[model samples]
Target chain A: MPANTLTDMILGFSVIIGILFLYILSLTLRFKQEKRKASLKNRRNIA
Target chain B: MINKPKLLTVFDILTALTLLGALALILFWTPVEITMGPVQKVFYFHVSAAWAGMLAFVAAGAAGAGYLITRKLHWDWVSLSAVEVGLVFGLIAILSGMIWAQPIWNTWWVWEPRLTTTAIMELIYLAYFILRSSLETPEKRARLSAVFAIISVITVPLTFFSIRLFRTIHPVVIAPGGGDSAFSMTPCMLRAFLISLGVFTILLVDLFWHRYRLAKLNYKNQTGEN
Candidate 1:
């Protein structure tokens, strides 16, 4: 419970949260990319 | 548009709740180690994340086997999704372990078997992505990646056991002194540990599902684009 080791705690949580955030961001990016592809396909069909 | 599964939505909420609960428990509820102190708390999640990441690698191998035998796109997607998730979580495990090690071991890294094997495994899986990206055809990409997945998985157990056996000689501090102490767990710590595992597993499933869906969509679009 020493104050010194608190840095590791912060670093650990930062890793956990940072990885989650990166995955979520990745999901959003992929979703958008897929959406664009789908929409473009639809426009081509309409044409 | 595909309907989001009701169960997965429920899982997302459950995952969030349990993970938050586990974090609170670790940060507030558990007794600080008398010697190692607060930083030791990271050990729980570090070990759990490493375990789950290993499991994900195994899942990728299974997916790869199914794909090779059945030649199903779904199986390929599963393998690919697992690889991606495994990479993310694996990196987390390594980083967290290193962070914990810096203080306890007085070294940021060691040339020990466990760390070395894990690093090698990460590189192998990372190369899977690079290989997939280089290919233009979906069928060839899937086939090649599947083969790589299965081959790469064989290294995981080798990595684990190699580390275990090597640890016996070096007698690292992190290694539990004996079988009984290794198995020993207080009820509170057990609860917190299990809860964290459950949350991480749920989170993995959710991410895999979402990634697979995106892959499916991408595949469909690619076919249509052709």
Candidate 2:
């Protein structure tokens, strides 16, 4: 029988997916933040 | 304000679905290696991520060339976006590789040639950001950053051939006679591996496009705002 590395496999996938998730989240947040800043600048200029 | 393209939305959905399908196939369809067991499965996406990361750097280098010839910030956006997305994929490859090594190598880290070269390559690209932020103007930043990216790309091929050049415990998956670190793959395993590579490449393109758009927006905001 091969050595059981099931825990390591799980950990590997989790880390891979977790990193992707976090990066995607950060990308989305940056877009929203940029949009908000644009809106605020527009409002100031109108005033 | 730029609106998101409908085609990009469709492409994003397809990429996500393909990624899920690829993961499921890897987990369920590929047979476990009798020697290494389940953890051998990590090799599929692990190597694929590394491939995507390298491809990104190459794209960045090509974009750098485009910037130098045309002097367009659009190419700069491509270069910057590729490096950013490349770093993420490179980090994923390194971390996933460490996990795989833990069980196979009986350690979390090693000073082996392949591993060391990879870490160095990642660090070289990471410095691209620091170099960009130090410049006083956008044109200066883009011009210098393009040169840095073009020069730093040497590390990619160096990292790639490290295992072939020197003795290392790292697996030589693509090398012939794959001594020591090589494992023979069954047909099913090969199919899954190819699918994973395709999926990751698509993911890399999607991420680069999104990032390029973000770079454009960031540039617009920095320059257009009073």
Fraction of the real A/B interface contacts present in each candidate? 0.57, 0.67
Across the candidates, what are chain A's individual TM-scores?
Answer: 0.91, 0.86
lDDT, each prediction: 0.81, 0.90
Compute DockQ for each candidate against the true complex: 0.62, 0.78
Error of 2 at B171 (Å): 0.9
Give a tens-digit lDDT track for model 1, residues B47-79: 777777888899999999999899988898899
Q: What is the number of residue pairs that collide in model 2?
A: 0
| lDDT, model 1 | 0.81
Model 2 Cα lDDT, one tens digit per residue, A1-47: 88899999999999999998998898888987777777777787799
True contacts kept of 2: 0.67
RMSD of 1: 2.8
Model 2, residue B16: displacement in angstroms? Answer: 0.8
Give the residue spans of candidate 1 off by over 4 A.
A1-3, B1-3, B168-177, B180-184
